[model samples]
Target: MIFPIRSKAKVLALALLVISAATWLYLSVGETEYGRSLGPVAPRFSPTASLLGDLESRLQEAEEENRKLRLQLGEVRNEEQGTGLGSEGENSSHCDHRSLTEKCELIHVAIVCAGHNSSRDVVTLVKSILFHRRNPLHLHLITDSVALRILGNLFNTWMVPSLQISFYNASKLKTDVAWIPNKHYSGIFGLLKLTLTKVLPSDLSKVIVLDTDITFATDIAELWAIFKKFTGQHVLGLVENQSDWYLGNLWKNHKPWPALGRGFNTGVILLLLDKLRMIGWEEMWRLTAERELMNMLSTSLADQDIFNAVIKSSPSLVYQLPCYWNVQLSDHTRSEQCYSELADLKVIHWNSPHKLRVKNKHVELFRTLYLTFLEYDGSLLRRELIGCPTDGEQQETRQEALSKLDEEDPCYDFRRESLASHRVHLSFLPHQTPPADPYDVTLVAQLSMDRLQMLELICRHWEGPMSLALYLSDAEAQQFLRYAQASEVLQSRTNVGYHVVYKEGQLYPVNLLRNVALKNAQTPYVFLSDIDFLPMYGLYESLKKSIAQLDSYRSPKALIVPAFETLRYRLSFPKSKAELLSMLDMGALYTFRYHVWEKGHAPTNYAKWRTAVTPYSVEWAPDFEPYVVVKRDCPEYDQRFLGFGWNKVSHIMELDAQVSRLVFLFNGSL
Candidate 1:
C-alpha cells in the first residue's frame, strides 16, 4: 500500500503546471487583479483597454466554470457519504421483477470480489467499464476488509458524479453464505450473487452482475438493453458456457440430467432481481440447504451451477446473450473463430493462464485498456475531460509507445495478437554520439516470437557505436518479414543485423542460435546474452572501458559480467547504472553461474539461484564456472547441445578446462 514518492511528485507537478498555466494565461491577458477592480484604463489606440475588458469578461466565465466544477465535486462527495438506502416500499416508482418493469435513470452494476489481488482487478475492471460507457454507474462492490481500504482510496480519488459507487463488505451482508453446514469453506463465494435480492436495495432491479476478471469493449448500457428484450419467463440472461468442462461436475451425481448444451459462464450475468425474488430464492436456498447439495456445492461448489441447474428444465427462464457479451478468451483453439468473435466482442473474460498467456494480443490489448482507466486523474464531473484520443492520436500514442520500448513501458503495450500474420518491422536506434575509441563488441542474442520488444530495449540502450545481431528462429520469420514500420527506425543503424537460422516448423535450436551469433560476430570481443536480458545503465558505457582492459591483457581471457533477477513484476529498470546497482530491493544480484536451462517457476520446481551474498547488499560473489566472458574465436560456444536444455554447461566446461588458463571476469554486473 506504500505510494511511490516519485509518482506522487509527478502527479503534484502535473496539477500545479495545469493551474499555473491557467493563471499565466489569465495574467497574459493584462487583467491583473489590481487593474480588474478599477476596470480597464484607457490607452492611446493600442486596443489595450478593449482587450482588458474582454479579458475581464472571460475571467468571469472561467470563474463561473470553476465554481460549477466545485459544486459538482461537492455533490458527488456528499452523495457518496450521506445517501441513505430507504426501504423499497417507500419508493412508489419501484416496480416488480415478475413484471420485468423496473425503471431507472442510472445503470446499476454489481461485481463480487474477495481477497487482496482480486480487489485490484475490481478497480481496473470498474475503471474500464466507466471509461467506455456513457452512463451514470452505481457500481456496488462486495468484498472483505482489505478491499474496503484499497478500493475506497481508488474510488474516492477517481470518483466522478457520473460514476458514483458504493462498497459493501460481503461479510457484513446477512445471508446463508455463512450457513454452509458441514462445508469446509467459511463462506461460499458463489452464494454471494444469490443473495442479491436480500442484500442490495430492494428497489434496484435489472442490475448487471459481473465477475471481477473482465474488460469492456463497448458501453455496458448495450448489455443493459438486453434486459428489455427479455419477455415472457425469460428473466436471467447470460452468455452460454465457454466449454463442456463444467458438464462433468454438473452431472457427476445426476440421475441423467438434461443436456446443458454449451453450459453457461455466469461471469457476465444480467440478473433480473425481481424474477429471482419471485421465482427462485426460497427453492434455490432449500436446494442449497440439502446436505448432499450443500456438500457438493461446497466441495466443488459453484453458485452458477446451481443457478443453471434450477433454470435448466425451462430454457425460457434463461435467455442466451450473444457470445461476444462474454467473449471467452480461454478457448483459443480456433484462430479464425476467435477473430470473428473479437470483432463483435462487448466483454472479454480472461479466466485462465492456460486459456490465454500474457503474450496473446487480446491479453495485451486488455492490459493497455486497463491501464488507460487506472491512470485517469480527472474528477467525476470532469470525466468529459478524460482522454478521448482521436484515431490519429491513439495511433500516434501507440507508435510513440513503440519507440520507447527500451523503457519497457506498459502504456505502449498493444496486446492484440491478431498481428500474428503481420510482421513487426524493427529498426535499431543507437547512441547519438559515438565514442572516440568506439566499443567494437557485437552484442548477440537469440530472438523468438514476442521478443522484438526486448530487442528494442537493448537497441535503445545500445549506445556508443556497437553492433547487435539477433538470431531469429523459424517461429519468428513471418513477423519480421512484413513488419509495419514504413520508415526504418530499427534499421537506423547499419551495424545491427538479423539472421534467421531455423525456418518455420523446425525445432528451436537454442545452442546453435547462440553459436551463430558467436561465429558471425564481426567484433574482436562479443557479449553473448539472451533476448530478455537488458543491461544495467552503465553496463554498455563501462563495457567500452572494460573491453579496453580485455584487449591489453597479455593473456587472452573471457569477461564474466554478472546479472540480476527482477524484483517487481514488469518493473522498469532503474534510470541509471548506479541507481540500478544501488536498488537493493528492485533486483537481486545473481552471483551464481548463469545457466542456459529455462528456469521454470521458481519457489516451486525450478532451483532458486542465490548466494551467501545478501540481496540489495551484495558487492560481489565468487566467480563460478564459464558464465565466462570471451575473446571472439578463442573459445566459441559449443553447438553440440541441440533444440534446448543444458545447452550452455558444456561450453562453460570447455572454456574452463582447455580454452584459457586465465579467465578475466568483468566486474561490472547487470
Candidate 2:
C-alpha cells in the first residue's frame, strides 16, 4: 500500500483514534473468549516474526504465572476437600480460624505407634484428627518400617487429598534404648517419644506427638495451637500428670518440692523442634552412659524421669497443659455412652501400666468406649455414644477388670452379676430296667498325645463290655506315644488299641479324628469317649440296659449320655459309679445340641433332650455325650468340619438331617 510520510504527533493522533474506535467496537460487539477481555483492542505494533518472538516471551511469562496460579488453586481445593473445612457437618468448634481461613498449611502431627499390632489404636487416633481438625495435615508416624509401610498403604487407600502421611522407621531408635532394662519402659516398647525428638525431620519446626493409646475428643488444630502458645524457653508442651510415684519421687529426691502438676504425661506432647535441637541429644546420650544418671533412671518410671531430670533446673522449660487435656485411666464407673457430658474432656488416656490387669468392670466398661472410638472413623460427633450393657463381652471384660481390682476395693459391688447359673445339673435316680447282657463296645478317642496313666486308668476302670481305641495324630509330637507305652499303661491293660495315622496339617481335625475311630471300631457298637474321660462300669451297665430296652444294641441308634467334668485325677480314678459320681462337677452343658437363637430348641435337662437327639431336628446340641453307642455302620462322622468346635457340630447336624434310620436316645451312663 502507498503511504505519505507524516510528523510523529499526527501519527500518534491517528494511533489514538484507532485505539478509541477499537475499544468502542469491543464494548458494543464483543469478540472471542466468553466473559473475558481480549487484551488491548488497538494493536501497538503490526504482526512480524520478531514481534511474535517478543509476544511469545511475554506469553511464556504469562503461562508460567498461570501455571503457578493453577497450582495454588489446586492446593486450595485439596485443602477444602481433605480438611472438610467450611464444609457442612464438620467440626468447627475449636478450629483455628486464622489457620483455616488463610492459605492452609500442613499441620505436621507426629505419632509414635509401635507397629501393626498398634495399627488399630493409631487408626483411631488418626481418624480422630481427621474428624476434629479442619486443617491440612502431615501425619508422621514413628514406628517400625513394617508398620510405616502398612500405615502408608492404608493412608493411600483412604486417599485423603488434604492430608499427607509419612512413616519414620523408629526401629533404629532401639539402639538409643538398648541400655534400658527390658522390664523398663524403653526395654518393653522401645525408647518411645524421647527418641522422637531426634528421629523427626530436622526441618519440621513444630509437631505434636502422641502415644498410640489415646483418643482426641478435641480438634488437633487446638493441639497445634500450643506451639504458638509456647514462651521463650519451653521445649515441651505436655499435660500435667498426677502420678503418685512421680510426685513422691520429686518430693523425696529433688531438694525443692516439685508440684505434682509439673509432672508431664509424655503420652500427649508438643515438641518445639528448634529448641530440642539446641538441647543437644549428645548430652542426653551422655546421661544414659553415666552411672549416676543410669541409677536414677533404673527407677521404674524412667522415661519421664529423664525428661524431668534434664529440665529440672528450669521447670519453666516444660509447658504444662490442663488436666482435662489428657484424662488418664480415670473413668471406671460407667461406660462412655453413660457420660452425660464429655464437654470438659479434650482427650482421654488409657494410662494403666497394667491395662491387661484391669479388674474394674466399670473400667472395662469405659474401655469399650475407647475401643469403639478406635473402630470409628475418628469423629466423636458421628459416634453412637451408648453403653453396651447387653453385650456379654462387657460383662466378661468387666469381670476381668473386677478380678484385678478385687484386691484393692473389697466392697466394689460387681454390678453385672457373676454367671452362677450354671444351667447344668445332675441327679441320682434308681434304675427302671434290669441290666442287659454285656455287649463289649469299643471306646474310641481322638488324640495327639495321651497321658499313659490317665489312659490306663480309663482302660482299667472301664468295666465289663468295653475296649479302648485311640486315633493318635501322626504328628512329631506323637512320639509322646512312646512315653505312654514306656509307662506300662498299655502293657497293664486289655485290648488298648494304639493306631497312629497321618493327618495333613498341624490342627487336630476333631471330625476326621472321630471318623477314624468310627471306621476302626471292631465291636458292632462304638462308645466314643475323650481320652480324659473315666468310664464307670456301673454307669455303663445302666446305660447298656437303656440301649437294649430301645432295641438299639444292634440298631442305628445314637445314645449320648451327658458328660461331666471330674475333680478326679488319674490317681483319683473312681472304681465304681458311686465314687465317680462323688468326683463329678456340674454337667458340661456349655455346648447346645441345637442353637437356641435359631430354629432348634435347646432342651431344659438331660432326660428331655435325649429323645430329641437326631438328624431330623436342625436345632440340636449333640456334643461329647461320652458314649454315643451307634452301630459301627452308622454314618461315619463327616470329616468336612474342622477344629474342636465345629467337627462335632457337623456330626450332630448330619444326624439331625435324618440321613439314616437314625434314632437319638439319652443313655444314663455319663
Candidate 3:
C-alpha cells in the first residue's frame, strides 16, 4: 500500500471527483414513487402545497394593499380582535360607523329572477333595499324575456338617485350549469348562481347576490361595509343554514348532500369576484361536482348543495355572517332564538315553499314587514338626484333646466320622450307625495285636455288615489298643470299622478295611455274607467268595503262596476244607486253604449244587475267594455289598438281569456 506523496494525492482527488459526479447525476434525475428517473429536474414540490401557498400569497397581497389604502384614508381596524370579519360570534359589532361620505361607494347587488311572477317578488326586494338605503346602488339582474319586460318598466319608472341597473339574459348560461341534475321547483334558475362570475362584467370585483324572496330592514350600506372586513383566504360570506336538512336527519331515508355542520344558506351571499377567478373557481367547482355527483342521484337544493360542498372542502374560503342578516323563516327552522338574541332584524328571508304562510310563530311579524314592502308606494323611492357637492351642481343645473320647461310656451309641442320608445313622457307631473297609507283602490283612467273638467267633479266624489294618463300636446300639458294648480280640489290632493303622452300624429294611443295609468297605480285594486265618466256618490268608499268583504285581494278577480250614460251633458249627476235606478226607469239614462252598440253593454246583463243584491259572475262576451275594478297587475291594454275602437274590448277579452272571472259589484258604477 506504500506509494509516493504525489501518487496518493492524485488517487484522493480522483475518488472525490467520482463521488461528486454520482451526486450530480442523482440530483439531475428526479425520483418518483418507485425511485425511477424522469430526466434532469429540480427537487419536487407538492402541487397541493404550492397551490395553497400561491393562493395565500395572492390573498395576502390583496389584504395588505387594502389595509394600506384604508390606513391612508385615516381608517384603523382593530388588531386585537382581528376586525371580527368572519367570526361566528352572535354579538359582534363589526358594522362600520364612518361617515357615508368617507365610504361613498356604489353597492353592487345581483339577483337571479325568471318566470312571470318573479318580477313581483323582485320589485318588493328592490323596494326593501331602497327603503333604508343610504348609499347608491348598481343592481345586476339575471332574468328571462318575460321578467325583463316587467322589471324594465318598473325600475325605469323608479327615479332613485344614483341607482343604476343592468340586466343579463339567463338563456346565455343554459348550457353552462344545465348538465347538473336538480329537483328544486326553481329548476335551472337555481343553478344560475354558479355562473355569476362568468355572467357579470369581468371588471366587477365584488357583489351581493340575493334571493328574490328576501327583504331588508336595515340600510344595505351596513351590509356593504362588511366587505372591508374580509381577511386573506376568505372569498365568500354566508349565513349558516337554519334548517336540519343538511344534517341528514329530517326524515328516515333522507340522503342529503354532504355538508359541514348545519351547512350554509345561499339565499344571501357575498362573492369576491377577483379572488374566485384567481383560484380557478370554474375548474375547482367542476371537479368537485364531478366527484360528488357520482354518489348522488340529483341535488335537492341545486347550487346550495354544491356551494356547501366546496365550503366543506375548504373552510378557510368563507366568512360566516350573523344570523340577523339572514333571518330564515322556513317552517322547518325556529328563528325565535335568533330574534330573542339579536337587537335588530336586518333581513327577512322567506325561504320555504309556503313563503309567508310558513309555520313559524313569528310568521305574522315577518309577513307584515313583507307585505309592507310589497304594497309600498314606489313613488317614495323617487328622491331627487342630489349627491355630493359636485353632483349638487349638476342637480341644480337640471332643476333650472326643468323650471325653464314650466315657463316655456304651454301650447308649444316639445318632442319630449323619456324612458319609453313611443315618444311618450312618463310622470310629466307625478303626485306631490305618497299618502300616509295606501288607498285601497286607485281610480285609473285615460283622459284628454277636453276632459280636464271631469277631474274636479271626480275628485269631489272620490277622495282615493287617482292615476291619470293624459294625451296632451305640450301646450295642453302646461294648461293642465295650471288647471291642476288652480283647482282647489285637484291641488289639495296628494295621491293623484298625471302621466302625459304627447298627441302624436293622428292615431291616439289609447291603450298605451291606459297601460301607463295602470302601471303607475300604487293601490292593490284599480277601477279602469274613462275620464268623461263621473263615479256615483260614495262609490270609492263602497268599493273599499266591498274589497274587504269579498277578500278579493287574496284571490284576484275583476269586480265589474255597472256603467250608465245620459244623452244630455247638463243632466244632474246621480246622487245614489236608487236615484240612478229611478232615472233609468224614467228613461233619463241608458246602459253605456246601449243605443249605439248593444253587444258592448249587453254582456253586463243590466236587467240582472239592477235586481241582484249580491255580486254575481258574468260570462265573457264579444265587445264587452264594462268598466271594472281589477288588480293593478292585470294584462296590459293592447297597444296595437289605436283611437277609440276595440280598445277596452281587447283588454277585457284578454282578461277573460286568462280565466279571470268578472263579478258584478252590487251598486258601484262609473
Candidate 4:
C-alpha cells in the first residue's frame, strides 16, 4: 500500500466520507419503516399487550361481581311474607279508648246503615275506619229516609266521645223487615237483604260487611288478626277467587256447594256472626227474600252471585283473603298511594266505570273546597247553628258574599282557576291579511302505444284543456280507434279529455296509470307528461311562474325542482335508438300539485308512491333538470347526461347534507 496520488486521494476522501454518513442515517431512520418519521427517541410499547389489557380489565370486574351475587341470591329466594303500615300520627284520636294490645280491644264497632247511600263516599270510609282502628269504634249509623239523612248529621257532628253513635230506623226495627225496596232493587241484592235482615245483630258474634265504597287502611286490629287466622270454624273472611269466577255455564252444572274458591267480593266481608247464626244465615235470608233468590240468580253478579251460592256447601269454612286485601279500583289499578294505602287497605274498591269521573286531583280538591267554603252559605241547619260565626255573621257574611258570588260558581270553578293559573285569556280578534293561493293547475299527458308520435307533439303543444292519460299496453278499442283516426293531434283535440288505461301487465302499467290519474284528474295541479317531452315555448309559462313564485314565498311543502327536456331518435327496423333512449329514460316529464298529486294518491302504485312519499324522494321526474333537452338526436346526442342527471347529483349531495340553499333548475348543457 504505497500511496502517492495525493495520498491515494486522501484515502479516497476518507472512504467516501464514511459512506456518506451511513447513508444519511439510513435515510433518516429507514425513511419511516412503515412511513412517517423525522427522528425521535424510541419509546414504543406492548408489554405482552400490556398484560393482555390488564387481564381484560380484571375479567370485566369478575363478571360484574358474578352478576351481583346472582341478583342477591334471587332476592333471597323471592322474599314474600308481607305487612307494613306506617305514617299516621297527630295525637291520632278517632276516640282513643285504649286497648293498645292484649290482642286488641275497644270494640263498639257499628257501621250498620239502613238505607245507606254513599253519604259523601262514606266520609272517606269513616276516615279510613278511623285511621286504622285498634279500638275506639262506634259508627252504627242505621238510617231510615233522607238516604242516610245528611250522613246522620255528619255523624252527629263528627262523633268521637269514644265515638258511640246510633241512628236505627226501618221505623225502629222489630221485624216487619223492609230495610230498603219500595221499588229500586237491582244490586247488592237489595242491600244484602237490608243488612242481613233489617240491620244485623241477632246476637252479633262478629261482623264487618263494609262496601259503602270501602276504604279502610289496615289495622281493623290487623284485619282482626287475619280474621281470626281465617275464621277457625269459618263462615267468611273473603278474597281468594279469581279465574274470573269460572267463566259462566252456570259454574259448570251447579256443583260447588262450598266450592272452596272463585267468587267472594261482597266488597269486603268478615262476618261469622256465630257462623252467620248457625248456618241458617237468617233462614238463608228469609229464603233469599221469599224465593226471589235474587230473581233466581239471573246473573247481575249482584250480591256476588248470592254470595257465590251461599258459600258453595261450606268449602272448609270459607277464607282466602290477600290481594293486598281488596284493591279493586281498575283502569289498570288506580294510585295516589291508592288513598294512603289505607292501612294496607283491607278494602279500597272504587271499582271503576271510571268511578264518577272528575279526578284531576279531584278537580283540584274540589277547587280548593270551593275556595274554602266560598263565603259559607249555610243550611246544614245554618252550619249547625253558627257554632263559629259572628263578626256580625262575618260582616253580614261579607255582604251576602258579594250578593251570592255568581251563585257559587263551581263546575270545576273555572276549570280550577285555569289549571291553577297557567294562564288562558284569549277572547278573539286578529287576522291582518295574508292567506290566498289554494291551487288550480292541471296538465296530465301519459299516453303510450309507442308514444303516438310523441302524443301528437303533446297535442300540438298543449294550449290548455290537456288531460290525456291513454296508456293502453296491448292496444285495443279498435287499436286505439285506429291510432286515433290517424292522429292530427287526435283531430285537433276534440276538447282534449281521454283516460283509457287498459294495460293488463306489469301490474297493469302500475295500476292503470295510477288509477286513471287518480280518478280523472280534475286539476289542482298535476302535469306528469310522457309523450316524448316537447314542452319548450316557455314550458307552461315557466311552470306557472315557478308556481306563482312558490305561492308567493313559503308555500313549498314539496316542489323543489324543474327544467327538463330530452328527445333523441334512431333505432332500426321497427324502431330502436335503444328503443329511443329507452323511451327517453322513462321519467315521463313531471310537474305536481293538486295537493301534491292529492298527497301522492296520484296514479296509484309504485306502492302508492312509496307510501305517499315517506322519507321523501318520489321519482318519475320528481322535477327533472339540465338544459331541459329541447332536441338532441345528433350522433346519438349526449348533452352530458340529462334529466334525473345522476339522480340530480345524488339529490344535490343529499340537499347539501340536509337543507340550505337548494335551488336547482338545470336546462341541460353539461
lDDT of each: 0.55, 0.52, 0.75, 0.42
Query: Model 3: residues >4 Å from true position, as ranges?
Result: 1-80, 83-88, 92-94, 98-101, 332-334, 384-386, 389-402, 405-512, 515-670
* lDDT of candidate 2 at residue 45, scale 0 to 100: 37
Candidate 3 per-residue C-alpha lDDT over 248-355 given as tens digits, one digit per residue, 9 for 90 to 100: 967888888888899999999999999999998888888888789999867899899999999999999998888878888877655655555334688889886687
Tens digits of per-residue lDDT for model 4 on 1-670?
6854334444555654555555556455533542454357754433466755665675566556556655544443233111111111111122122323333244434443333234434445655565545454555555545435545544443323344456556445524444323232333233443355336556657756666666654566655554445435677777644334334455556432233355666666666676666766766644554454334434344455546665664466676566545655543323333344333334545543354353534334423332222212111111111222222333344355455455456532332222110100010011111123334344554555666566666655555445555545222423665666676656665445555443321222322342343334444444544455555443554555555555554422233323223332432211322332344346332223323333322322223322232222333233322221110110112212222224333332333333323332322110
Ranking by TM-score: 3, 1, 2, 4
List clash counts for every candidate, in order.
23, 21, 2, 23
Better-scoring candidate (TM-score), 1 or 3: 3
Q: Residue 96 of model 2: what lDDT?
A: 40
Displacement of residue 503 (Cα, Å) in model 1 is 46
Q: Per-residue CA lDDT of candidate 2, range 194-289, in tens?
A: 676677787888788777777777677666765665666888887656445444644545432233334666777778888877977546534633
lDDT winner between candidates 2 and 3? 3
In terms of lDDT, the poorest run of 10 residues in model 4 is 421-430
Indicate the worst ten consecutive residues by lDDT in candidate 3.
Answer: 411-420
TM-score for candidate 1, please give it. Answer: 0.40
* Worst 10 contiguous positions by lDDT, candidate 2: 422-431
For each candidate, give its TM-score against the true structure: 0.40, 0.40, 0.54, 0.20
Stretches of candidate 4 off by over 4 Å are 1-54, 64-112, 115-124, 129-143, 150-215, 218-305, 310-670
